[model samples]
Target: MKLIDLNPQGGIGANSIYLQIGDVNILIDSGLNPKQAGRLAMPDFSLIKDISLDLIIITHCHLDHIGSLPVIMRQHPNAKVVMTHSSKMILDRMLHNSANVMLRQKEENNIPDYPLFTHEEVDRCVPRFTGMEFLQPQKFKGKTDEVEIMMHHAGHVAGACAVELHHKDRHIFVTGDVLFENQRTLRGAQFPSGHFDTVIMETTRGTTERQVGKERVNEVSRLIASINDTINRGGSFLLPVFALGRMQEILSIIHDARKFGRLVKCPIYAAGMGMALADYFDEISRKYQHVQFNRNIIKELNIQPTARKLDAGKDLKQNALYIISSGMLVERTPSYTLASGLIGSDKNTIGFVGYCDPDTPGGQLLQAKQGEDFTFATANVTTKLQARVERFELSGHADREELAEFAIQTQARSVVLTHGDQAARDWFTKELESKMPGSKIIDPVPLKTYEL
Candidate 1:
């Protein structure tokens, strides 16, 4: 078997890996770097763009993992696309939404590669996708060899999965953005106690060893308390969420809070593709009994869809909770527009609920003080950030301790870490080295092949 890391300069952006078991060449993911644009966002496809892949397995529909899929499917038209049924439903919404976002970016930012692939391409790619249920074995029988592949829930999003590839004596496991703890809308990854020859795991949060004495339950309690306080103060609260997992998780939490009388009722609003995904989540919960999902929590939460021009209606109408998208508040998104409108007010709360890249507008807002003047770079909209700014760690990825425990449980002979910064990767490298001394911890070079 052979393994190659397509993403060398990694940080949870363009994650792609080439795994060849016998004569079958399968690509784990073809993702676009969220930080980059046009061709730069894509994984180094120059590695095997021309070669026809036996299969292309997508773990989920997040942009970092599935954004560049159309770009590759355009090249390798014959490769069978496989993902979970829930992912298929979510992907359809996300990719179409992405195309529209790119079109908007092209017109506004003068970006040449704004819509990297057209909606037409995404439309064409859907028919080719083979949506499968978790734990089902998918076999690829070559003339001389046979490899069995199974997709298991990764617990990162609605339909994220980890791929288990086995050929003869060698078994390889690819942990695709895995999470171990249960979230509001999804459960943790469900891979059982097992051993493999090689394990390719993500190191997204490996570097940020969570602050001691801070627990997830405490974080949740604090966030709920913060929300309740902001609303009780008659301040409009804004939660900027990613449309996929974070939005669903946040909504579920808020819905439960309201149900239990922990949160007093105000107007609840949800906008962007997240509203669409809630329906899909409801559908998945009904169709797949195994999926740990809520049944139309968005509907039950009385969350009205906000207008596209959210700024016009965001008049701080007495203790309303606004849940909007483009979690990072990237330029033209509704969250940014609403935030720009509310930044000048002292009675409002702009709460960020997920990881914000410091390069994004949302991340920059994290550094701004109460009296500091802030400007939305995308729109040149300026305001004094008098509004209360609170950030909570509702990240979907597992933390350092969880990841280390995953490595310990998998018991793979060799482990390769991807999807994190240098410090994060270094931390995991050292920890794994000390803990799993019997196994090899490989620090892979981008685009370099490591044979097993």
Candidate 2:
């Protein structure tokens, strides 16, 4: 088997790995960089433009993982796109919303080739999609060898999964974005751990561990208390959330907190693609009752949808929790607009519940001190920082310890780390060294390939 690094620099942006075993070639994921613009944002599709892929396996529907998919599909129209039934239901919403965001960027910033691929292109690719149920092995009809594929529950999002390929006497696993601990809407992944030749996995959260000395439940309780404190103080609380898993998890956590009287009851609101995803979660949960997460958490919580763009100078009136998308408060998102209006209020809280790139507006605000004046170029607004800005361990990725534990479980002779920054990979390299000293750890340098 030859493992090819298709990512441009392999530094956690635009992740794509070309796996060629026997006669067939499989592209693990097709992602677009969230930080770059135009063709530069793509995963150098030029790398595999000449190769014919038998299958394109997507791990989830997140933009960084699935955004540039249509760009490749337009080239290999016959390739079968495989994902979970849950991912299939949300892919359309994600792509369409992405198209809208790109169009807006084109008009506002004059970003040439901004849309990348149109909504019409995305619509055309759906018929060829094959959404499979979890753990059901499907044989791939390749030319040279017999390969059976299975997607285990990834537990990151509603339908996210870890890809397992059983070929001949070998087992190869590629963990998409993974979360081992159970969250509100889904249970953690139960991978079929055994001996293996190669395991390509994510190291997205290795740089930092989960909240120190607190289990996930306790960490959440603290977040709820913070939310309650702000609401009770008559200040609106803004939760800048990603529209997918984070939105659902936060909604459920807030709901349960209020239901059990652990948090003060207050109005809750959610906006953008998250509301659409909640509908899918409800559908999946109702159909698959055995699944650990409940999809109807939004309905149960009575979380209202906030106005897409709050009028300038008109902030939220009452004590409430407003959940908005673009977790990092990207310009044009509801969170960005709302943050502009609430940044000066001392009683208000702008809680960041997930990872933020240090260069993004959200990251900048998180690092800012009280009473500091900062400008958000995205929203074209400047404000003084007085509100509380806090980050929770409410991450979608497993922490460093959890990742180490998973690496040891695989027992693979070679463990290849993908999908993390320099600090995260360095931490994992040392952690895995201490934990699994018997195995070989391969860190794929940007634009370089490692053979196993």
Candidate 3:
């Protein structure tokens, strides 16, 4: 058996990996960086194109894992696509939305350097999906023989999973963004306590020491209290968050605090898809009761949108607490426009909820270098917002200790780390090697192959 890292070497972007066993090829993920389309750079598929691809398993709906799947399927039309039911549903929505965004950008800019696939391609790929339930083992027809596969809950998102493959006398495990402990929306990753021949793990947060659970919650509470204090002094709070996991978690926290009278009853505005995602959480509360604090509160919380539009009228800006999306302050989002309007004022506070790419405007704001003025863009109007900026340690990824403990407990013969920067992967490999002797740790460069 051999493992190949096809793209996204060094964990910056565009992640793809291939597992080859003789003539049988199993493609785990086929993601591409967004900037590649403009550069017209295509992934090299010469290694797997000659061999018959038996299966294409997707771990989750994140673009970095499943983004290039439509194009890949077009190249290899016979390969069977497999993922969880919920993952398929979310993937469909995400791909369609992404395609639409690309098309819109192409038209708006009149540029020919956008994405290659169309909405029609996304539509065709949807029917080829085969949904697999968690923990159920299935056999697929390989080029030479049958390969047994198992899907386990990864706890990253709704219906995310880790893949386990068994063939001949060897077993391999692939962890796709696992959460070690229970979070607001999903259960922690669960693997059968046993030894394996090889294990492939993601180390997105491997280099950093995660804040303790209690400390995380306390930090969020304190930030909220600070916002509330500003509001009591006749100010408003602005939080730009991702519309997915982080948004739902923060909403639940605020709702719980408000229910117990820990927070004031000011109007909380949820802009963009956050309102819809919160509703989805409420609708699917039963399925995720294991991770929720109070399912009843989730059901009863009124998550109505306070600001219907993004005009940024003075009255609207002065009254409600706003939670908006495009957490990075990217274009075509309400958060960017709002930030541009509120940055010069001392009556508003901007709270960053999750990780921000350093190149993004939100990231620049968080860095807050010495003697630099924060700027935001709003529909051709540039504004400077001078509100307080703060960060809360509410990441969904597992901490360093949790990841080390998980690796030690698995006791695999060999470990391969991915989905992190080179520094993070190296740190994890060194620490795990020192703590757990006799286990081999390897960090393969992008497109490199390792034989086992």
Candidate 4:
């Protein structure tokens, strides 16, 4: 098999992969980088512009996985696009939201290349999407070769999946953004057992060691306790989360805490595409057995919309719980602006629940010490970091040990790592080399082709 990493900037950004087996050419995903703006945020489609793609497989609906779908679909009009049934239901919504964000960025950030694809372009790509049931084998023929494709349930978000490809007798698996542990509203990943010829996996949490006594259940309790402590002290608590999966999952967890009287009574403020996605999650849960979210949770929690314009360095003093988006606290986002105002106060709390890229504001804050000077550059606010900054092990990715064990158990002759920073990939490379002496471990460079 021949492969190329199409993400121009690499390091978990613009996550597109090109694979060629026999006469078949496949594209795994077309994602945009949240850190970069305009055309630079998208995958380098120019690498495969001349090649006729046979199939496009969408692993999930996260912006980092399917953000550039419309761009790729426009170039490969003849290629077939496939995703899990649940992903198919939410793909359009995610893309439309992305387009809207790009349009706003174009004006706000002064990027002329913003709005890479229009809403109409997204609509045109929708008719081509073919949703498939998990583990159901579907065959696609090339000029002289064919491959059977199947998707397995990968517990990261509502409709995430890991791709399995069978070309002739050689088996290949691609682990998209995956989470093996169960979350409040989603079950753990249900991957197949056994061996394969080649394995491509995500190494997201490679640098994060598995700590003892910090499992999901315990972490949930700690989070609730922290929120209660902050609320009772008459201070607000902020949860910076991704709008797609994290928002819904965190809200569900909080609802359970309140239902059992384990949480304190305080005003809950949440608004964004995530709130709108609750309706879709409710629909998905009712129609499918895999998901477990209900839109009624919003009503039960008495959620309120966040104030339209949040001023920097000015706290509202509501003593409320704020759950907002741009999980990594990207510049100019709701979380970034609100955090600027709340971080100077010693009474407030800011807790993170998912992976944060080292280059993002959230990661910088995590590395900062209490009473240190922190700067919110975009908001023009600089102050002493007095607020409580905590991180829960409630990430949406599997632990490094579990993922490495899975790859080692597969015993694939060639193991390739994707979707991680350089440090993360390095850790996985060292771990795999020491344990699996006979296997070939690869970390492909961006836009570089490798034959395995």
Candidate 4: residue 297 Cα off by (Å): 1.1
lDDT of candidate model 3 versus the reference: 0.72
Which runs of model 1 end up more than 4 angstroms from their true locations?
Answer: 211-213, 292-296, 312-318
What are the candidates' C-alpha RMSDs?
A: 2.3, 1.9, 3.2, 0.8
Q: lDDT tens digits, residues 157-228, model 2?
A: 878899989888888888888888888778887787677778888998877856555678878988988988
Q: Could you give the candidate ranking by TM-score, starting with the highest?
A: 4, 2, 1, 3
Question: Which prediction has more favorable lDDT, 1 or 4?
Answer: 4
* lDDT (10s digit) by residue, model 1, range 38-67: 788889888886667888999988888888
lDDT (CA) for every model shown?
0.82, 0.82, 0.72, 0.93
The deviation in Å at residue 296 for candidate 1 is: 4.7
What's the CA RMSD of model 3 in angstroms?
Answer: 3.2
Better of 2 and 4 by lDDT: 4
- In model 4, what lDDT does residue 412 have? 93
TM-score pick, better of 1 and 3: 1
Model 3 clash tally? 7
Model 3: per-residue Cα lDDT over 1-452, one tens digit each: 88888764357356678887655689997775543453233344666677667789998776667767887898889999999766765677777766876777788766586565778888998999998878889988775677888998787666678899888888888888777666666677776667788888888776677655646667767877977886886777888887666677777777767878888767667776656655555544545443453335434655446455665424355556777887778765778767766665677777886766555778777887433565554356544545677777666666667777777788888898888777788889889899778888988876677987
Backbone clashes, each candidate = 2, 1, 7, 0
Identify the leading candidate in terms of lDDT. 4
